[model samples]
Structures are given as C-alpha cells and as structure tokens.
Target: MKPWLVVAWKEIFESLRDRRTLLTSLIIAPLLGPVLFSGMMQFTLAKENKDHEQRVEAGVLGADHAPQLLLWLQAQGLKRVPAPATESLVTAAVRNSQPKIVLVIPADYGEQLSAGKPASVKLYVDTSDSDARRAGERLQRLLAGYAAQTAALRLMARGIDPSIIQPVVTDEIDVSTPASRAQALLGVLSYFLLLSTLVGGMYLAIDATAGERERGSLEPLLALPVSRDALVAGKLLATMVFAAASLLLTLVTFIVALRFVPLESIGMSANLGPLVALQLWLSLLPFVPLAAALLTLIASFARSFREAQSWMTGVLLIPTLPIMLAVVAGLKPTSALMAIPSLSQHFLVSRLLRDEAIPLPEMLLSVGGTLTLAALLSALVVALWRHEKLLG
Candidate 1:
C-alpha cells in the first residue's frame, strides 16, 4: 500500500474506535439539522394555527358614542367586550382581560362625525404581547377602511369623483414562488448544512496531528521512510472524507424531514427531493477539501489535543460569519462574489433551495475558486510540517 494511504487508513480506524468522536461527528452532527428545522417548523405552525382559530376580542370603551363604527367592527368579526371607564383602565384591560386590544372613542365622537370633523379613536394595546400587536394592526386597517369609505361618500355628495382624491394607484406584485418565499424561513438550514462540513472533520484533524504528537507517536512515525508531504496529504485526505460524509448525511436528513413539515400551511414549499439533494451534494463537494485542509493546517500548530480543539472552535466561526452577514444584510448572489469559498457555497445552496437555475459560468467560478484555494492551503500545510517548530 502507498504510505499516505496507510496513514489515512490508520487515522480512520482510530477515529471510528473512539465512541465520543463517532457520537459527535457521525450521529449528532448529521441529526442536528433535521431535528432543529422540524422543531422550529412545528412550533411556528402551531402558533399560526392557534392564532387563526381564535377570534380577536376588542374592548370598546365608548361603544355608545360610535354605533356605526361598532357595527363596522362587528361586521369584520371582531368580538366586542365592554371596556373600563378610563384610559388607564383600558390599558389594564388589555393585560388582564381576554381582549387583546381596547378601542377608546371620545365622548364627542358621534358629534364630530355628524359635523363632518375628524373623530379620534385610540387603541390601547400591550406592544410586548405578540397577539395584542397583531390585533392592534388588524384594528388599524379596519379603521382605515372605514375612513376611506366615509371620505368617498362625502366626495360623492359634493359631486366630486373620489378617484380624483387619489392621484396615484400603486400595485405590488410578488414575483417569488412558494419555494422561493420559503427560503426566508429556512435560511438557517443553509448555515447548519455548511457547518456540518467544518465540524465533521474537526475531531479527526485534531486527533491525527496534535493527539498523535501528544501521545509521543508522531516523532517515531516521522522517522519512517514516508515523505512529510505524503503524511500531510494522508491526514488531509482523511479529513476530507469525513467532511464529505457529514455533508451528505445532513442533506439526506433534510430531505426526509422536509417532507413531513407542514410548510404548505404557511404558503411555502421546499422540494428537497432526491435530485435536489444530489445537486446540493455536488455543489458542496469542493468545500470538503477546502475545510479539511484549512482545519488540518490550524490543528498542526497545536501542541496538544485540547489546544487543537480550542483553536478549531474559533476557526470554525470563520465560515459561519459570511452566512450571518448574508442573513442580516439580505445579500444577493453575484458572479464576482462567487469567487469567495464559503460565501460561494452558501449562495449556491440558497439558489438551489429557491429552485433558481444557477448560471454555468458562476458555478464553474465557485468550484474552481474553492479548489484553487484548497490546493494553496494544502501546500502551506506541507511547508509547515517541514519546519523544525512542527515537532515542538
């Protein structure tokens, strides 16, 4: 057998024997995405369903003053409850009563409307309460609708066209399909998918380099006939294998979990079938070698297994930073941006999730750029292994 292959086989065998490493890398890491996504979707769907079924109870402080408005609210299916005497009481009612919103109409509300003057209606709600916030928004829209109708009627009586009062007609048309729209909800899944690659090979990289050195085996192994470059290559190859396996497992788990999620209820669809999973796996392939080489390089500098783990924890954050920035800034993918390694893979995965066709040139640029960087890093790792401090 080739020297590098022999070393890689030894590393893989040792890693598989460690129960802790296998539990974290093979089992927990792969299962994390599916479990997390499923739990979040279930919670969100349950909350939305509960909200839809329950009727909004509105407390009306001066119901007698605005009979017409009360009728309009009733027509919109809002359940009316008798409100308290004062504004302070209305605030208390929102917190204590079943009513999520309290509508306070002034004593002169009817008089002002009859005289064609503006009548003030105040909504008292606990903004901290999500249910109250939603109820308040609905009440605001209902009031606006009533105001517009009244204004149109008044304009008609004055022999003026109501359309003349509005100079512009604005229409907003959404171009996103259900799958594209669902990307917002499933954005975190991309981060986790990319993260699996970094995490899966981390333990093996640390164990092969720092752990072996700490156990006093590295010096004896280095004295062998195999070249330093081959040893590094062997470890790099092992790390890449683990990373690739982790990514593949995560993609498969996501495909299965997505099928059971009630995404259709939220007007979103995730078609992560076998073909999509295959495409995602292909797009992520180059990243495995890149992540492995980078991690192995860092782990090589550590003096002990625990030190390597500490360094890797900080290094793993590097790949996740781009994903965080993309989420916060709502980054759109461009050809130039595809040259960046982790960022490129993230954009490709997002495009796949949205069911958008990736341009051939951009795809080539991402894969080529990542592979080139991986080769450069691997050379650096080889050079580092030749240095005298590598033993210290």
Candidate 2:
C-alpha cells in the first residue's frame, strides 16, 4: 500500500474512534447547517408576516383627548388598551405573551389641541420592537389624516378652500430588484457560510498537525522511506478533504432548509433549485484548500496541539474583516476580488446563489490561484516536517 493511503486510513480510523470528532464531522455539523438556515428563515418570515397582521394591539396613556379617534382607530384594526401602572410591567408582559405596544402620551395633550396655539402631543414608542414601530407608523398616518379632515371641516365652516392650504404631494417608487433588496439579509448569510466553513475545519486542522505531533507518531512516520513531500501531501489532502466535506455538508443542509421558506417574503425571487445550490457548493470548493492548507500550515508551526488550536482559533477569526466590510459597504463581486480566500467564496456563493452565471475565466482564475496557494503552503509544511526542531 502507498504510504499516503496508509497514513490516510490510519488517520481516518483514529478519527473514527474518537466518537466526538466523528459525531461533529458527520452528524452535528450537518445538522447545524440546516438548523441555522431554518432558524434564520423562521425569524425573517415572522418579521415580514408581522405587518400583514389583522390588528395592532396598542396601549395608550392619553386616549382621553382622542377618545373618538381612538374608537375610529379600533374600527380600523387598531385595538387600544389602557397603559399599565408601570413600563416595566408592560415590557415583561410583552416579553412573555402576545404582542404589546406601549404608547406613552404626554400630559396636557387635549388642552393644547383645543387651545389651537401650536399644540403638540408627544408619543413614546418602542423603536426596538418592529411590531410597535409598524403600529406607530400606521397610527401616525391615521392621526395625520384625522388632523387634515378636521382642518378641512373647520375651514369649510369659514368658507375657505382647504385644498389651497395643502397643494403639494409626496410620492415614492421602489425599483429595487428582489435580490438587491435582500442585500443586507443575504450579506448575513455570506458571513454565516464563511464562519461555518472556517471554524468548522479548525478542529480537524488542529488534529491533523498538532495531534499528530503530540501523539509521538509523527517522528516515526517521518523516519519511513516516504519523502517529506508525500507525507505533507497526504496530511494536507486529508485536512482538505475534512474541511471540504464539512463545508459541503453545511451548504447542502442550508439549501435544504431554505426550501421550506417562502423566499418572496425575504425579498428573494425564489428558493434555489438543486442545480443552483450545487453550483454554490462548487463555488465554495476552492476555499477548501485555502482554509485547510492555511490553517494546517499555521497549526503545523506550533509546538503543541493546544498551542496550535489557540493560534488557529485567532487565524479562523480573520475572515470577519472582509465579511463585516461586505455587510456595511455592499461589495460587488468584481473579477479582481476573487483571490481573497474566504472573500472569494463569499463573492462567488452570493452570485451563484441567484443563479447568475459566473464567467468561466474568472472561475478558473479563482480555482487556479487557490490551488497554487495550497501547493505553496503544502510545500512549506513539508519543509517544516523536514526540520529537526519543528517536527521532533
């Protein structure tokens, strides 16, 4: 048998024996991808459907001034409850049960409106609550219309044209594509995929390098007739296979989870088909070598598995830099940006997600560049393995 196969089979058997790693690699990681995606879909669907609600459960502190208006609002799906004695009580109830909106109406609301001397009423709303905020906006529109009708009625009694008082109008049009509309939401998914891929492989990479070194097996393995290059190649191949497998598992689960969702609710055109999702998996393939080779090389440099684990944990964090930038700046996937490790996957996956055809040339460039980097790193690992201090 080839030494590399022997190494691979040995490592695989050892890894299989460690039930925790086996469970994490095969079951936990796979399930996590679906659970993560499904959770996000549920949250988004809940948020989007909240607006189509039949009624807005509102609490008012100063309904006395607009009792009639409040009654009218109730007729229009706006149910008002009297405010509780304390805000904390309201918040606690809101946290536990059905939706609640606490509206604090300032004192002296009716007197100022009746006086007609620049009367102003203050309304306190929970901006953090989407339901509350939507209710607030709807209520504001209702009040504005009420005020306008009231003004017109008063003016008509005096025989004045209220139309002249409000001649201008404001209008808005939304021309955003569904994909572009979901940019922030999609950007979040990109971050998650990056995280799932990078952190997912950290354990395997740490084990392949540091674990081997610590187990006293690395020195004897190096003493065999097999070249250091072959050994490094075998190990690098093993780690890449592990990372790629985990990444592929997550991508598949996430796609399956998305299938249960109504994509239109989140401003996406539709759920991805098997082909498009498969494309996304292929797009992330390049990152396999990038992540594994990078992490394995870095971990191999460490003296101990724990030490390597510590260092790679921080290295695993480096992707957040580009991810956050992509989120805030709304990055476009241009050709020049394809070589940036995790960022490359982010760009390509997002593009492939929408079923957009990635140019062949650009795809080759990314794949080629990543493979070259992987080769260079594997060569470096071999060099390290050849060293007395580093390997022994």
* TM-score winner: 1
Clashing pairs in 2: none
Q: So what's the TM-score on candidate 1?
A: 0.89
Which has the greatest lDDT? 1
lDDT of 2 by residue, 212-308 (tens): 8898877877788898767766666676676667777777777777777777765576445677667777877777777777887898888788898
Clashes of 1: 0
Note the residue pairs that clash in candidate 1. Answer: none
Against the true structure, what is each candidate's TM-score?
0.89, 0.82
Angstrom error of the Cα, residue 37, model 1: value is 2.3
**CA lDDT, every model vs. true structure:** 0.86, 0.70
